[model samples]
Target chain A: MTSLTLNAIVSQMAAIEQFTNNILKILEQDARTTPAQIAVMTGRTEQEVKDQIAALEQKGIIKRYKTVIDWAKAGRERTYAFIDVKVTPSRGVGFDDVAERIYKYPEVQSVYLVSGEYDLRVVVAGTSLKEVSFFVSEKLATIDNVQATITHFVLKRYKEDFEIFEDTSEDRRLSVAP
Target chain B: MKPISHIAKTVPASGIRKFFDIVSQMDDVISLGVGEPDFVTPWRIREACIYSLEKGYTNYTSNYGLLELRKHISTYLNERWGLHYNPENQILVTVGVSEGLDLAMRAILNPGEEVLIPEPSYVSYKPCVLFAGGVPVPLGTTPESGFKVTPEQIAAAVTPRTKALLISYPSNPTGATISREELQAIVDVAREHDLFIISDEIYDRLTYEGHHTAVPELNGAYERTILLNGFSKAYAMTGWRIAYAASTPDVIEAMMKIHQYTMLCAPIMSQMAAIEAIKNCGRECDEMAEEYNRRRRLIVAGLNNIGLDCTIPGGAFYAFPSIKKTGLTSEEFSERLLFEEKVAVVPGNAFGECGEGYIRCSYATGIDQIKIALERMERFVENLGVEGRLKAAGRE
Candidate 1:
């Protein structure tokens, strides 16, 4: 392609990135922000906002809209642990195959192939400590190429999913201030 | 015992004082009263403060605040809006914009000198001027004028005794902001009159419409304008109490003289946090402004839908809606709304005389709370009888 065409493509890409970021940033903060409201806030037409969102959804860039719930506040208890796993890679597959196999279990909330001492970092959730330990020994240890597992159970969650779990900080500002 | 100083006795308590007393006693009140952000200071900025404490930085630096923080603020102002101030002598890190305003007033005003103030504005502007022994001449702004004081009004309000003109864009009570051209005209008037300019831009970052015009950036304004801005509204650091004033070195020195005698220095932890905020929290600040913009749309539309005539505020986090159609005074409307619907909105009269027929509702709270408040306000407005509703419709 000509330099002129490349420059035009680059500028267009930047514009598209900015446009999507404006809409996505708002939705990321509050998923329920309407297109009409987004239009007014972003200086775009409501129809345009709607179309852009639809296109994003179709492209699979925009996924689920979820609520960050504090389950403990709802009188329920869930024990979670971050397990570091040492994996033996198979020929030509590396950690991907083992990670895929480990993530297939229902208890695993998230699986990340991280660097450093651990080959894989898995977040597992269970109703109790014993349940998680049982899964770590029986289900996870039983898998092939799973060399060893080190589990660190979350003690008290102060925050999760960018939401503070137990925020009792009252509004300390004056009721009426300039 | 000495009758408390004549100035202190004469200056009336804040107009919102009555509501403050009453609101404090109420339970489960959905308040849109206070003009502060709902978000806590970003964790990174707060962590910076913690780190400062951990590093044992409890001692005061210079009366002008930490040099590193001042340099960061200087760079931020210049990079953000082309406003430059020397970090050494041209900036004073204040406790908040509140202190900045007070210092600006005291530093510039001579006894009995007049300061032109646009109303309804930030409540502290008039009192600050008065406390500094400057006579405050309020330039009334109306809904027809979009709650903006025109250059013509500022010119008319100016007298021979006028020492300075105080202006705040993206103003509290009304989210009104002045355009660059308009501000230039106001600055021109100030120049023509040989008056100083004190520009309180605490709500500068919260401006929703056009870009904020830093007064000092305008031609002929840099020398005379005392530019006040802070991290309170934008960075959600109100409790942290970090703000600054930028101006000429001479004026800063004079302000520093008073500050040294009284405040000495702003808290070191807050200064450290402010340094972090200015350097690294730009994205967090922008995101908060975006959130405020979304909430601004909701509350403005909600107020209009409830039969209140609300002008679209161009900036800040407030929605100043006319409650005149309800056939009640500003105080009466606010009191009734609070008692009847458990929604707390400041009466416009609390801002100024021109604000008497309106009410100032802050949109800084959560979306769900705003929605609930709007519903309650709708019911309250409906219960005001057919005559009031008819008046509202007639105005429409």
Candidate 2:
């Protein structure tokens, strides 16, 4: 293809990418935004919005719509802890194998291969502190190539997943203004 | 008993006074009538005020307001829209845009002179003019032009006694924003008529569709324009009561003379907090505008779908929808909607008589609340249709 045509195609792709980014941002803010609503908000047709969202889902970029809940407020308490792990690299695979093994347990909520002294950070949840400690000492520490671990229990959560947990804000504005 | 001053007694109360009494007594009313933002003042700005109190900076500053706050306002205006106003003599911070409007009117108007204002505008414009001992001439703008007043209409309204033209773009009831080119045409008419332009741009930052054109930025407008703006709508600082007016030195002096003698100055804490707002809260302002835009689209679309025949408002949070098809006056429609559906919207006539046959629905509430309001409105319209048919049958 000529360079001029290639440039045109590249710019067109960039525009589409920008449009997709905008749609993703809206959905991230409120997943319940329907195709028709998104269409009006983004100045696109409903069919076009539906098609883009479907494509995003197929690409795994649009993940599951999960609720951010305050379990303690809802009368369900779970002990949550963040575990820092140091691992000996297995030459080629390094910390990837150890991180995978640690994350495979059902109690592990999430695992990240992080920098600093610890090679991995693992988040775990259980019904009690003892239950969570047992998961870390018995299950996580036993993983291959794991050298040492440090665990910190979360006492209180002020905010989580971009939502303030203890929201006391009210609509104190006047009912009507000039 | 001796009567009160004639002007003070005769100046009309807000048209929403009756609705306020009823709405205050009712429970579970989802109100879309509020003109201010639903957001709390950003905590950082509030904290700045607390810090000022702790440091004992509570005494009144200059009559023109704090020099620091004025400098920041000057810099902010220049940076945002390239409009220049010297902080020392050209900017006078007032108690709110409310005070700024009063001061602008009092400073500029002579007794019996006329101020031509577009109809269906903010509630205070006419009252302020009257208090300034001026006649307010209303130039009606229809929904066919998206509630925007044309230069031709303005020219026609201009008379020898027309001393000033007052306008608020991204207006209160209709949410109409003027494009820069369109505004220039209006400015041209003002210049041709040699009329002072009092531009109340309190809703400038809340503009959704396009960038707001500061009136002073227009060619030859700076020398003739009295620009009024405030921190209320944009920074969620309505309660703070901090706003400013920028104009020529002579005009500012005139306004400051009135302000110093009557109002003295805006509160020190509000001025301090306003400085922090201008310095650090641009991002928060943008985020609020984006959210308003999203809600604006949803509410406008929902209003149209529910048979309200609303034009898309370009700025601010209001959606002015026509209720003519329902065979009810604006007041009747608003009253019935509030009583039956538990949804509160301002009757359009509250803004002006030209606003009759329409209702202003504010989309400043939550998305869920908007969705519920739309459903209620839809149900109400369907019931009205059935009731209309029944009434016709009874007549036959």
Candidate 3:
């Protein structure tokens, strides 16, 4: 069944039969947190917790789980960069494909299409910008779309992230009654 | 490939840069993206660069930077923000606040430690964190909320792994600022959580509404905070690329080691230019900021008159106006406007997902350019309305 209609969002029938929200939340944070543990915390049966995680995984919300590894100590100097560029013309053509090629360089960390003098500001680093530039000149520039490049090699790094943040009503953290 | 072993293969690129490239090719595009100051580098600052050349100061600075320049930074920070940064060790001169940010990310963030990002923010924060092998958690602050992240918001975003909470006021994209009371409460949360504060006050001097507030102004917050600032926006010297970060001796020592190897030094002449820029920060910063303020009001008022609703940006020279009426996503509106009308604007989604439905219009262009652009925009919108194009184009 596909959700063609918005009303199909939280189906009443789907809400019953072990697809409870509490089990999913528990699984999302710690998929290994036992159904029994979830039952203790969420007041759901162990069977229900197991069923919800299975359902949520099917929904693609509970993607594959992984552990965080500290690789900075594993003999690599992590480098960050912000390279501002002046982009060339890409009218009436598959410009994005060309842009993608330039961005695909192994040295490229990220490529942003920014406003100002630089058309494409890339974020990439290697052992050094020398390594970064080798990829830029040999790989990125050779990608056919890149016109002019100016590298603002990062002399230092301050911050980054990839998690979701939201504002809720009831203040979930405060209402948790910790 | 000099393959960066041990790092995650995937690093996210900012969606905004693509639009910037698109707008660059089109003629007559007046841009408000990029969060750059509209004014040219103050004459004093520019003259300083020329002066440095005349003096032939063309050698690399000491790894930490010119002693005189560091002194000026310490003095500037103390006078402006009432904070003390030891010139000898607590401060390390960087290429720009961009580099200062990178250094901090390198120094403090070990893999898997959480660094909380408050958005819509400068495009750099999240990418920098991820590259450092740290996990980035974003906190969304909306326009309805003046884009200010509250203490409660900070607390909710924290997990046990949360090593740092960020504060960027006179912010980019949103132009939202934090009140002292609100900041103090955030400081309290950091103390409770035992988290560090990464304070980005790059927009510190351009605050039009009132005096700027820093998380470092609070008692314990300064000790636990890494201060990042630069001459880019404030001094209108983005090209010169001189900025620095301030922290305790231990943290700075850690960062300086990374910086020395990463970038042996910022351009020698750029440091010379910064020495002059800092000494003349008083009038040089104010004159350009005042002009930016005038342009800021004009653009905001004009956008509103043209039927694009925009909130008053308290600081920075950008007015982010919602283009929902134009019935275009930030990209569609920006692209068509560039190709058809020749007006350049950055789509809001470039900053974060929340920035969708809006476009960042920089007031950095001349008053005449803004006025003409506004007139063209009014015509564009009116024409779209008459043709029933905007609404029909799937814009609500």
Candidate 4:
């Protein structure tokens, strides 16, 4: 009876692995792959695909779908910069409090507690280099516990999130070929 | 009217062209027809090309391609498959494997000589042989054996005028991979008959179950093998049109002569990019292959679940599901699937006669599209009635 229970547990684990692994992979590759479409791909019924996706969402595993856009190609003029900050860790919370405060601003795209000379690396985006500089000099540098800052404005984006920006090659594949 | 040559006139247009035309006119059709990756070329590789362009690399490379690119390819092949070829004389870059195949056939084949080709394979192989004034002898492989060519089939197909054995493992339509032992058997047969081997390994990097065995790596096979590989499938550099053929010096020189007169060289920008790709893009290629493997599992399971009787392919991104239960030929099934459900998969018969009862669905598209397509196909299959479903399940 114990062995039988173990077998059931093992099979249940296998089922969970199958469901989660397949759904996560599909979603990660293209989050746009809808529940209905995922159902067909994974051999699950539409309802099952929906249930698994909903469960994943409820569990906070499925986050959000993002479009990889080449802003340069779209003729959108924008400035991006990476600001490395030397921060004094708070007594009780260490870098968490400072990192959290820096990330609250709309312009601060991402903040990370990084190693090396700088403690926090904040990535900020703005309409112009001047605006980004202003944000860094005024808001970012003035934040409590921020000791110093180093700003590196991004000159050009060759790539972002696995998408190559300036590729001229057209897809030459035939619609149907052996 | 322009005067078409006799050979050109005799060669039939690709059977898929009409379907492509129809597909082009339709809207909202989810296609699993194309045999190319959905991913673009990795950014670092594209950046290398852009850097090359900025540095003014617009000029044509040598007819044999850049020495740097060749050396990298040589190192890559040696490291990956334990195959060695002199970059100076044994490798010639061509405009993708398409041109390499043509060059190899033209370089070796005499008029009316036969190249034994496994059927339901790449569409280009037979036509390339025909255009080169060589006969293509079809060696039929079946779904029963996972579409792999057997030693018996190869032995039976060999005849007096047979010049070479042309094979593409991790095959396109069927997504079958020939094992190292199986390939060794074929190599033995080739040696017995004293025939050359033309191996297209474009999909070498996409294998899931086992590592691909380059035919030239087999014992007694290296000297007589013309190995064709390209960056198109592996690196998602299809449009860059870079491929190389490695062979004995004599074959390479012969192919180079034709290549010089016809192609001149592969694009210089692409060559520079390829150098970067071979040097730096191993992790990206592995990630893409892993993604494809996941999709492969999903699509295979979905097909089998839908009662299509699909064999789980060992490599390549296609799922060659048998559609025989619909009581329709491959063409009928493909047409109905496209029109009724708005899901387009190539009729398997487009590959060859042996592909009659199946359809080739590529899992290279987004999982969402694959899922949607599967749903539509399942609905279509269910509407075929209980008898059809039973027949597909092999219980009828």
lDDT of 1 by residue, B1-396 (tens): 558888899889988887988998988999999878988899999999999899999998799999998999999999988988999999999999999999999999899999998999788888898999889999899888888888889878878898999888988888998899988998999999999999988888888787899999999999999999999988999988889999999999999999999999999999999989999998998888877887887788889988898889889899999998778999999998999999999999888888899999998898778889999999998878665666669962
Q: How much is A102 displaced in model 4, in angstroms?
A: 7.5
Candidate 3 deviates by what RMSD?
Answer: 28.5
Candidate 4 docking: what grade? acceptable
Off by over 4 Å in 1: A1-49, A67-76, A92-94, A128-134, B386-396
DockQ in order: 0.49, 0.58, 0.01, 0.30
Q: Considering every candidate listed, which one attains the maximal lDDT?
A: 2
> Candidates' lDDT values, in order?
0.89, 0.91, 0.75, 0.88
Q: How close is candidate 4 to the true structure, as a TM-score?
A: 0.79
Docking category of candidate 3: incorrect
How high is the lDDT of residue A128 in model 4? Answer: 91
Worst 10 contiguous positions by lDDT, candidate 1 chain B: B387-396
Q: List the residue pairs that clash in candidate 1.
A: none
**Per-residue CA lDDT of candidate 4, range B1-396, in tens?**
988899899888887787898887887888899888988899899999999999999998899999999999999999988888999999998999999999999999999999999979888788999999999998888888889888889889889999999999889988999889999999999999999999999999999877789999999999999999999989999889999999999999999999999989998998999999999999899879877876887788889989999998888889999988778999999998899899889988888899999999998886667778889999988877765777779998
TM-score to true structure, per model: 0.90, 0.94, 0.66, 0.79
- Which residue segments of model 4 deviate by more than 4 Å? A1-111, A114-174, B1-3, B386-396
